[model samples]
Target: MDIVLAPLATDITCAPSTAVGQGGALIEARSDREAITRWLIEYRHSPATFRHYRKEAERFVLWLEFRGLSLDALRRHHLDEFEQFLTNPLPSSHWTGPTRPRHHPRWRPFRSGLAPASRRQSLVILQGLCGWLKEAGWVTHNPFALMRDRRRRLDNAAPPVIERYFEREWWCAMWKLLDPPVEDAPQRSRFLIARRRFLFGFAYLMAPRIAEISRARMNDFRLEEGQWWWHVVGKGNKVARLPVPDDMMTLLREWRAELGLSDMPPPHDDSPVLRALDRRRGVTDNQLYRVFKDGFSMLSDALIARNWSQDHPLIEQLRRATPHWLRHTSLTHQAQSGIELRYLAMNARHARLETTARYLHAENDEWQRQQARHRLSRIE
Candidate 1:
């Protein structure tokens, strides 16, 4: 059987079949693909969550098609095999390709093999899908429930240390590159320089996720009781009003002025904070991601031009840095500056102190110093 690999959960509004599955199903979805589409609709309000769940579900469905099986036909042993497959998807030609539009003929299910964390996340999502399907009577039982070590395999209780952030020295260097003197900056590129300055300044100070930055509007920044605050709709559709510091407000003012807006945007102004080259329309999340990616690449080139080794820690970090690193850098720097854990959690919008605590590296610094005491004495 030659299975042509293609995306499966692309259409959220895909009509469920009138026919029902075995075991008195509640949902009208007869096929695995339709059932997965129904499940994906549950996350429609959360775009990020919808995209994530769809990717995992689509991959699983493609894998099932390759195995000549259906979702309800999944077994514990099959899941174990799928888990292994995620690490090294076989016949890479069919399973992997560079990112492309879903409708593109060359589009594949994966960019490459999943790492351990990514594999765990994929399994967790599929586990939830099976649980939901069981409740909807699409399946007789959740195959995930059959696994003896399900909890141990899926739980991510131990928080990994946050390492993907710019250290102080590197951050300072980046700022210098981002904010060259007005005289030195070319007139044609002033708008771009100002935008980059404000963009990264906003990221470091507010620690907003890329989507938040993309969706931000001028009126999101407002004055209240002699202070400015940025109103945002963040992860899980939660609304938050974060303080706008003096530095960030200055950057906002500069960016707004460059766009020919008032120093402080009026309450009724819903213009996008991050504008396109036209200075009118908003940029998408992918565009925002590219801005950071290209900025880091440019910074890496600048460092190399300055005779910095490619292997230098800062250059290497820049090579791997993504937009999310700004958020990590913001929170980690705040933790290092002795901000109370409670306040740090509030700033990060994290529900648990344990999650925020991962940013704390003071103990690590002290431990390193303590270990230094055990070094062998110098020869006379």
Candidate 2:
């Protein structure tokens, strides 16, 4: 028989249970579910973090339900089994399904089995949860602690090299398609063309994440001390002020005019910078993601129509590109253009310098040049 488990509610808040763990309890949470909920509450202010942590925790709980075990009963062997399960997620009919509403009868814990990187991320989140639970006296031990080389396994010593970004030639080709001259523009509607130009321009120039752009309003862009700045609430609920270049300001003005607004946004105007075609409401992140996906698909079709092979590298890149690739492209290009590392980190809003350093490819180029000197017989 297939196992059925209802996903936890996002707004779950319940009074502490009376049960206690093996250790002297510090938190009031008694059951494993309640304890996990307590841990999730700490990240309530950070929606992205909360959602991610909750998903991993919920999946573990559901897996435990399948095995008829509890968090407190987990051991190194159980942890090992869970790690293996993450890779395959057996009984596919019960564990995997297409995306659906959380409350939908057909909703499943996973859309598919986790990839290696995703599995690592899932383990990292669960490790943190287990540590917290141990501190709260909800569990007797943390199974992650028993694993050898835990630090190397759980944390990346160096940031992974960024590969999911556009090359200059690819970016130029895409821009040509996006911002063709009036005489050369494709059959797309004027409104759509204008929106695409502004949307891509904003993404490439500001390098804001999809959520930041979707939630932005006209008031977020303001003239401050003779300079334009974009105020944004970024990841972890951190607020930042990013400098807006003259070209970006011009683009904003043109986009506003296209929307029938004044050249310069009026002070305190809360209108969304990007809006629905038939309505004034702001678009959701999912909608913005679709916009990028559709744009890439169109670009791919255009290339194919022009005799580009289906298996071309550029075509493959476009097929795999997601909205996040824009941020990667912007940062990587900025690094290549000689932007200092410190400023790049600030612009990217990364907490660590190492994270920003992943975009630096100058060292790789120099290394390649040095390696070229080594040969079976040096050519004079």
lDDT tens digits, residue span 216-252, model 2: 9999998888888899999999999999988799888
| lDDT (tens digit, per residue) of candidate 1 on 107-150 | 88888899776798898888899999888878778888888987
In order of appearance, the predictions have TM-scores of 0.89, 0.91
Off by over 4 Å in 1: 1-3, 9-23, 146-149, 180-188, 369-380
Name the best candidate (by TM-score).
2
Note the clash tally of each candidate.
0, 0
- lDDT for position 222 in model 1: 88
